[model samples]
Target: MTTSKITAEDVAAGVAELVPDAAPVEVVRPLRQGRSHASWVLESSRGWLVGKVLLGPAGTAGLERLAEHRRLWQHGIAVPPVLAFTESCASVADRPLTVFEYVPGVDAEEALPALEPAVVLEVMRATGTALAALHQVPVEGFDDAASGLGTISATWNTVVTSRVEALRDAYRFVDDIPAALVKTGLDLLDSLAEEVSPVARPAVAHLDVYLPNILLDDEGRFRVLLDLEHVRWVDPAMDFVKPAMWMFPDQQSWAEAFADGYRAAGPWPACWSERMAVATGLELLTGVKYWTQVADHAMREDYLRRLRAWVRSDGADHVWSAISSAT
Candidate 1:
């Protein structure tokens, strides 16, 4: 079935098939669509639940996400529990549909701005603690493509190089991005590729740790971490990319609070500055492409501006600087 044709009744029917014992879905409220998936909040006879439909080409990503969620849940992380899933439900055609227990809290992104400064910092600190716990989870191997939840089987430098090349190739086809900005981005990525070294060990990294994925309780404590589809086995420092780009650039105190909390758990990694810088640069390049494709000109332009500033400022250590000052 086409996405537009999907309705609350259709989703309720699909859920019944996957979870035979589930309570009848009483109400279905659509949530904002993510880059790769569409989600809905469901009120059922049992309780509240969430239904997600994988809309992207990543065929096995739903399975991979389920595995990641279970793994995190096993480690005592605050992730929503998967209730049921089907690879091809009649409601969504060939797309994957998964249901999870609904997390009851407000998204940190929307809630933080209205909160007091100290409260915001406290939330950031808690977020850092959670992320530190996430990076401590053991990963068995570099790549496990057979399970569709794999990291690349290459040295860290090689991974950076490959990502840079992929971004370069992607940027070539875009017409609006300035030629000079592209050169700066490519040159900075090349430099970063040479600077990074192999990580001591692979860890479970939630590469998308921005505010929207973070849910906070009324007390300003982190309640649930959502959207595990981008989970990967990579250098723990790589996880800082999203926050560094989206969270810390303007709010140094929040960055410091987060870094302090992370350091409280363990020694911060060596060469963290360079590693996070590289990760942020890669994200900026990828973000530009993503926003452009989605026809979000404001977001696309914002990414372009950040990319130019970051590359021109000698891989500006703003994120690292804030993090380091907390030490």
Candidate 2:
């Protein structure tokens, strides 16, 4: 499908600027479901390339994402190395674009749900192994910013607290969410965050580490973890909980497979189960406000329903029990 606001000509021009004698752009197929960038797959005389276009008010992590991918690659993680990148795209409203050699596969999200339950667990087990490998890259702070005089929180605890406070401060306008429910969830996360603080330190984490970003080959093997922009230096438990809550919520097999994968890769931090419970609560509490702001008004009922059941049902303890067995 043709991508809107971008065209074959746009891609050709973008490529020509970098490689004057490069093959003419032949195929340009749009890639959708992206929340941030307008992206495409371009086939040119040169070869196949995946192109990402960023055209908006400048955000912080664009360049850092590319850098972090290389960092992960250097640390023994398999990631697609950027072939060509440019932050200047004056031809299309000052959009910035990066071209990478494409890594092909069906999205794990689309692939896993169709398979048998045991097969799904195996794929996620592999995904968890990959995640643990990436998490082995140590980070110094809560964000992608280089740890510096003013760029980092004094303690990991401060980072966690500051995040909740920031959410509490800014998400006040999300009236669609029940205030009592939000408060209860946040309070749970706050307590959990504190309980885990005694052992917190910076570890590489992908905040949105879930099946959607994972690419799976035809044989049910893990291909690659696609997006790297939300990569952070936080508790590895954050990475653990992210998948549990999003990809296969309350699915014991999913949790079991993931924990086994983590163990398969190597030993992880101690007390991971408890830390993950805290992380789950944090993600659940903040996700209401976060997703509410990001999603359309039509999604209100869905988010509310899922969140309400979880918050009202002793969600954290139940979640911990379901997943902790895997450890």
Candidate 3:
């Protein structure tokens, strides 16, 4: 459920248990950290790899992720091949762990601004190509058991309503939730849920597609997509919301290049772009509670500002203006 507090001794011992006589075991913290799992680099005769310790019990999510990793690899996505997966462990501080090949490439976060402009373009193009292939995967089933398989929702709207309610409930634990904010969120969720047309089954998407998760080669070409913990079968539009709302707003040319590469590999539905835009607005509004309550107070204002800006975005601008006037 969170990143573990792991030590070199624990990892070394865990590695030994996973593979007898697996030495000389060396564990080092990675330069970049993940949100839910503490990642470490493991160096041994077997090969250089990364080990992740899930802070909480693995249960269904951990096992399901291993299966999904295999499936993604089978589909030829540029993801790290998972080497070892285990839920229970006596040697690794009694936590669940997954080990995979340590990508030998530069992280996009490190290479983006410091590198030449051409390099960033290369990264975008490669990322687009991989995303195209990833989206090609057919929707096997619906609903998220976290692994993208479990109950099926006939309509995405049904799922949206449920999620909005869940987010609202989660805000109860927030330190100080103003009544007006809750009312505004509930109203937006109601209106947005009504606006979406019925959609086909969900698609396999990398729920988190930020630049940090993407790795680039020395030339700034995307090589691997990492951090595959929460990937699931969800709204196809969910995948592009980040790029459309965040990435595109920052770099117009880079976003266009990525878009061109994606379109070249396969056919995009005429409405896919519109769906993504709507999803962006909906996601922004829904996430406001989490940002304000769960996140650090320092980030609260900036997060709320982004959400307010989203109100002025494509499909949301007019609705938000009316709400503003009414209030």
Candidate 4:
């Protein structure tokens, strides 16, 4: 679908017209900082706020994001509030846009490394608890139709049997990977249908739970989890694996501490290790595919680097093994 390019000026004007009491301050562009959507920093007399506009007039997903923001907020998750959203195409560019009140805090990724290990572990524990709370909220209106996972899974299954062979034939790197490794990876993918079945839950997940989406207060508290665009009702495991995205580099101690803190908030699922393994493997594959699809010079390099790392790393294998053991 074609995305409507709505300018900041258009967003400012729309917000002013809609919320008369809201004094317009300034609209700052959030360029290249985010993926899948364009966002801006807006300052009003009310305070600093963040506003986002879908890339094109195609706003099918934007509406869902707006609703998710409201839902999470109502459920006591700290997220930017939606000041206004419209599909009326009132912008000078006639593009669909949604504006939100921006919350102030640094993303967790930027801040996590500077903190002491103990502090980082605590924050991660808080993050796990927060996610548990989010999952507890009963979501309505969003069904499986609300996800990209089904289509993603179908596409992956079809390609798993052939894409590896095709890529090997097309690229020199293909030969760099051992045939045994390829067969093992392919076996995991082929059995994805059965192995991934047990952990599936129809609960609302934060979807993308990387450090960037988490925000921290000055005291190192988990202030707010942001970015609900990818939020959906899916496996709870999807939200649980986020701390590993950044905290994994810290040490095993952190993971264990986080696990303790998470269990303090709620019960861990039976066979949790296996569930995380499958989710982590899928996460790696998703990251690799994202780079491949971007079709840009930098993206290609990034993709190849990650693909290389996945080939060498045993993390994905650990995930697969955990799942296999569970069955």
Q: Write the per-residue lDDT of candidate 2 for residues 1-327, one digit (tens) a residue.
A: 223566646765676565544557555677664777776777866677776776553244556666667678778785666766666665445567666677777888788767777777778788888888887776656552222113555455666677767777866887666787777776666666677777766667767777778888887677888877666667777776557557666577777787788778867777666676666666666666767787765455555665676566645453454655545
Top candidate on TM-score is 1
Residue 129 of model 4, lDDT score: 78
Query: lDDT values of the candidates?
Result: 0.74, 0.67, 0.66, 0.58
- Candidate 4 lDDT for residue 240: 55
Candidate 1 per-residue C-alpha lDDT over 1-327 given as tens digits, one digit per residue, 9 for 90 to 100: 687677767777777677767767755678778877888888776688888887854456557757777778888876888877777887666567888888888889889878988889888888888888888877764433122354555555655666667777877787777777877787787777577755434677777888999999877778877888877776677687778778887778888898887887766777766767776676677788778877899999888887877777767643455555533
Q: Which digits, one per residue and each the tens of the lDDT, describe model 4 over residues 4-108?
A: 455666667766665666666577655334765676776677777665665555355556656766877877876667777766546535555666777767788
Top lDDT prediction, candidate number: 1
Model 4 residue 168 lDDT score? 38
Clashes of each: 0, 0, 0, 6
- Between which residue pairs do clashes occur in model 2? none
Give the Cα error of residue 219 in candidate 1, in Å. 3.1
The full ranking of all candidates by lDDT, starting with the best, is 1, 2, 3, 4
Poorest 10 consecutive residues by lDDT, candidate 2? 142-151
Candidate 2 error regions (>4 Å): 1-4, 15-25, 44-46, 113-121, 144-150, 295-315, 318-320
**True-vs-predicted CA distance for residue 83, candidate 4, Å:** 3.0
Candidate 1, position 308, lDDT: 79
Winner on lDDT (2 vs 4):
2
Q: Between which residue pairs do clashes occur in model 1?
A: none
